[model samples]
Target: MQQLFKNYINTFRGLSKEIWWLALITLINRAGTMVIPFLSLYLKEDLHFTVSHVGWVMSAFGLGSVAGSWLGGKLTDMFGFYKIMIWSLLATGFLFIALQFINTFESICIGIFIVMMVADAFRPAMFVALNAYSKPENKIRSLTLIRLAINLGFSAGPAIGGLIITGLGYAGLFWVDGLTCIIATLVMINVLHPKKAKVLDEIKNEYPISAYKDGTFLIFLLAMALFGIVFLQYFSTITIYYKDIHSLSELQIGLILGLNGLLIFIFEMPLIKWLENTTYTKLKLMLFGVVLTGLSLLVLNLTSWSGILIAGMILMTIGEMIAFPFSNAFAVERAQKGNQGEYMALYSISFSIAHIFGHNAGLQMTYKFGFDITWYLVALVAFVCAIILYFLNKKLKTITN
Candidate 1:
């Protein structure tokens, strides 16, 4: 136990000091997000909305995320991450808090969407700004640490959210989640400032993000959108599969999903070390993830064993860890120095698009097709994603090298 504890501390120590702030910020953000994982549940269970109405709410959130994705980079570039962040926290917090009062399905759906867009707008800004500030030597390490914080919060958030819902009910959970964001904003106010790094100047001095405008960035975004379609299926449709087919509880689902993020927390850095200095190879590695993910989905339909599901989740996590970092590294690596925020913002759009399809259309498709068909469809999507990346990899390699 002592040896294990020591090793754990040292793993974190391997990251740059800047990551400590990221870890803290991620925790605060995740804490604020306590409302997120259980949001669909809140809508269905508390507000008693029809499934279609729930879909609209999810759509609204996705729309907001899209807006944020487009604007986040420019805001970071213009106003700086600090100022925009301030606005994002307050906006999201109020939106979350406001949801507590709505009894109507339409109001809940439309209102939350607007709130989500406003709140989520701050996300990429934080990501890009921190990426801009950190030393290049630690880019992968820093990103890994950030992902770790997000997972840690993710791991904890649902369990806590459920507990709050159980005890104080959904409104209580919403209020708490909102407060958490408000607090994170306060801490962030100190972490970023009114005046700070001149991102444009830094780009000129170091790895220029602008150099990536050669079109590889657009290709990367295309692949990301495709991959995201497959990835988002986990949240939107998989839950129904577990509950309807396997009779799994919310706790069980949380544990299953948490496994993916947990594996990433443990192995992401070492994996990156093994793949060192080659973001282009991420395309191929992500294909392996695609297969594992496909396998994971298959396991759910093919078997009824609880242990088997857990095992499949572990494999899926490995695939996620493998693919996500490489994708991020490739995009950032190819970006022009000054345009890191813009690039990250553009990449974020893929996930937003994915979420939109995943929750809305993906859910409808899953409901109609069933798991056997859904898993197969998901696998086909993964294969297509791999194919797209393969062609992009060929071109990206030439440009990068």
Candidate 2:
């Protein structure tokens, strides 16, 4: 056990101190990420909206994410990540608090949209910061470390969110969520501010708009969009599945989701570290991950037993651990130094587009066809996407090499 623990520490040993601080910031921010995971439930249970209305609310959040990612990238390139990161954190915090007052359907949709827009804007800047602080060989592990922090924080968020919901209601969830965002913003102000400023200056020194023109990247973006649509269902559609189909309460839903984070936190970093030494290409690893994702979703159709949900969640989390960091690494490696923000922004947008279509469309399909058929369809989409990504990765290697 001691040696195993030592190996895990060794996996993360050599990253720059700034990278650690960045991971800390991610931890603090995501620790309060209570609102979104439960937002669909909140809208349904508290606001008494139908499942279709819940889809629209999630889709609205996705739309804001799209705008924020685009605008954040442009601003990060122009002004540097430091200023953009700080403001985004502060704004998202305030917006979470604002969501409590919105009671009407239209009002709720607009509020959720604005909050996601402001909150998601933080992503591109954070990616840029990761790139700036880490060495080339360490990039994937650095991303893994950050992801581990996020998972750890997320593990806490939902479990605690469940308790808060039981005791203080949904409004209390927002206050705590917002307060953590503000706390993270202060950490950025005091701890990460001065050190990351030089990295931001370096980012600003080169500015290229060619990420839009890269054909390989465009195909990669498409693949990401498809995968995101499948993966994000866990966030939007699956919560509904748990509540409506399985008849679980909000606290039960939180525990199940929290299980996903707990598994990732325990396994992701070590797995990625081990992968670093393997002969596997990034695409191969990604293909494996995507396949697991399809299997995870398809398993639901095979069984109605709630215990099977754990199996499905495990598969999904494993797939995430394998796929997401490598995908980010591929983008970073392919991007020109001056345009990291732009490339990362486009990458962020893929998930946002998923948000736009995945939930709204997913719910509509489920409402029409039922969960079994809907999940089967999602599995099929994953299968097709994996095939495309496999070929595209081969083609990209030929082009780049």
Candidate 3:
């Protein structure tokens, strides 16, 4: 036991101080993301809102994300990462705390908009910093460590949130999340704040935020948009599906959902090293992941048992872990030096755009067609995404090469 523990630390010894700090921040941020798992529960049980109302509120977060990505990129180009990140952290923390008092959807909408914009702005800055700090060979490793930290927090957050919700209810989850954000804000402020000299270099002479003009970068963004639209079902409708359709127990649901993050934590390092050499084909994994995710849902329709559904979810999780790290790495590598935030922001924008239509459409399908039909519809979208990705990957490869 002692030998294994020492070896584990030795393996990760290659990680830089900055990457370690980023990893720590990743943990904090993911703990914040845990609130989403219980968001619907909170809205319906605590806020006394309808399912549709919850949808609208969640959609508002997506809108904020859209604004955040564009504005964050612009600000990173103008003001620098440290300032944007520090402000973003404090703003999100305050928003989480403020949710303690909001009464209506309209108020919640405005609050979430501010929270997401600030939180998302910091997200791309962290990505930019990670990319800048990596030493060529360690890019994927750095990404995987970041992913692992996040998944760890994600795994813990939901289980803890679920328990808190069960015991003290939604407001309890909010207080805990608010506290997590406060600490995360402080951590980012102290540990990861970038130097002022570096800020001047990025901001001086006023570089155009025309990061959208980079053709390969644009193609990468679109590919990921399609990928995200396909991937979100794992979180959105699927959570509801497990409860309403499969009649899964809360503990079982936690286990099934938690498996994804656990596997990612265990497998990410080895997988990153193996995939280190892959380039434009990075998108191919995403294509396959979507297919696998769609296929899992398809298989779920054929099974009424909780065990089978759990198995299918495990498969979908594997696909996600495989796909996302590659997609993120591709976006970072394609950007010019000093413009990583803009590039990552551009990459993130694809997902934000996909969400605008994906969830609304998904809710409609779930209501009108039943869980099985929703699965089929999600499958079709994933299939289309896979085909488009394959075609675009070839074009991107030719252009990039």
Candidate 4:
């Protein structure tokens, strides 16, 4: 037992202090991620929006994310990750607070779009910062460490957010979300001083090419976007499904969502560590993970029993744990071939595109057809994407060999 505990601890051993600080900042920021998880609920219940209106608003959120990711990537490449990270966080803090004041349908859509634009800009810049702070060998583990912080915060956010909604209402969610961004910004400024950090020289590829010109990478991004679409349903229509179909309370829903994060927190790092030592290719692992994710959605259709909800969540969480970090590492590896900022931006933007379409499609399908149909459709998408990724992996290997 003691040896097992030590082995788990050793997985985190080689990461740099700056990476730890970055993880801490991510923890602080993500811990207050209360609003998005509950945004559909808030719109439907508090604002009394129709299902269609909710879909439109969520789509707007995705549109903003795409714009933000593009702008952030460009800016980070031009200006440097440190400046972009600081400004994005600071701006996002203010925007979240401002979002509370806008109540109408059009205004709220505009509000969410603006807020996400500023917020998601942080993503690519943070990735660049990870590149700067981490040693070459430690990049994947550093990414995993940051993801662990994110999951930990996610676990806490929903449970606390549910309580906050119960006590202080949805308005409280905005305030908490806003304040945490500000606090995270302050911590970043204080701890991760730009002057003290070590920025590694960009990896020089033998035949460097623009990320735009990379055909294989673009295909990979498409698969990522599809994965994002399937994964993001957890934040959107699935919440509504739990509420309307299963008749779960807000707290129960929050706890269930929190369970996804808690499981990732407990298992993901050690799992990644174990996988790192194995002979399995990252692409092969990702394919397996994607298959698991599809199964997770399919599991939901198997039974109406609430016990199945836990079963589905477990499958989805495991899939996420396996897929996301490796996918991130793959993107980073690709980014090193040319412009890191541009490549990473496109990677983030793929998910942004997913956000734009995924939520609306899920909601509209649920409204028109039903949750079961929506699950089947999304599961099909996941399975199809997995097949594409499999082919892409083979092509990549051929090129390398």
Best by lDDT: 4
Off by over 4 Å in 1: 1-14, 194-201, 205-214, 277-280, 398-401
All candidates' TM-scores? Answer: 0.89, 0.96, 0.90, 0.98
Best TM-score among the predictions, by candidate number: 4
lDDT of 4 by residue, 324-378 (tens): 9999999998898888889999999999999999999999999999999999999
Predicted candidate 3, C-alpha RMSD: 3.1
After TM-score superposition, what is the CA distance of residue 129 in candidate 3 from its true location, in Å?
1.1
Tens digits of per-residue lDDT for model 1 on 337-381? 456667777778778877676676656666576667878777777
Answer with 1 or 3, whichever has the higher TM-score.
Answer: 3
The Cα error of candidate 1 at residue 87, in Å, is: 1.9
For residues 1-401, what per-residue lDDT tens digits would candidate 3 score against the true structure? 79966655554767667778878977987876766766655666578876677667767777888889878877876776667777777777777777768869899878777777777787677776776566666777788889899888878777776677668766776777777878887987787656522221122224634566777667667767766766776666777777777776555556666777887777666666655556536777777777787787788877687777767867787777777888777776666543666777887778877766566566657777777887787788778878877887888779768
What's the best-to-worst order under lDDT?
A: 4, 2, 3, 1
User: lDDT value for candidate 4?
Assistant: 0.92
For residues 287-335, write the lDDT of model 2, one tens digit per residue.
8899999889999988789988889999999999999989989887766
Better of 2 and 3 by TM-score: 2
Which regions of candidate 2 deviate over 4 angstroms? Answer: 195-209
lDDT of 2: 0.87
RMSD of each: 3.1, 1.7, 3.1, 1.2
The lDDT of each candidate is: 0.70, 0.87, 0.72, 0.92
Where does candidate 3 stray beyond 4 Å? Answer: 1-13, 193-209, 249-251, 277-280
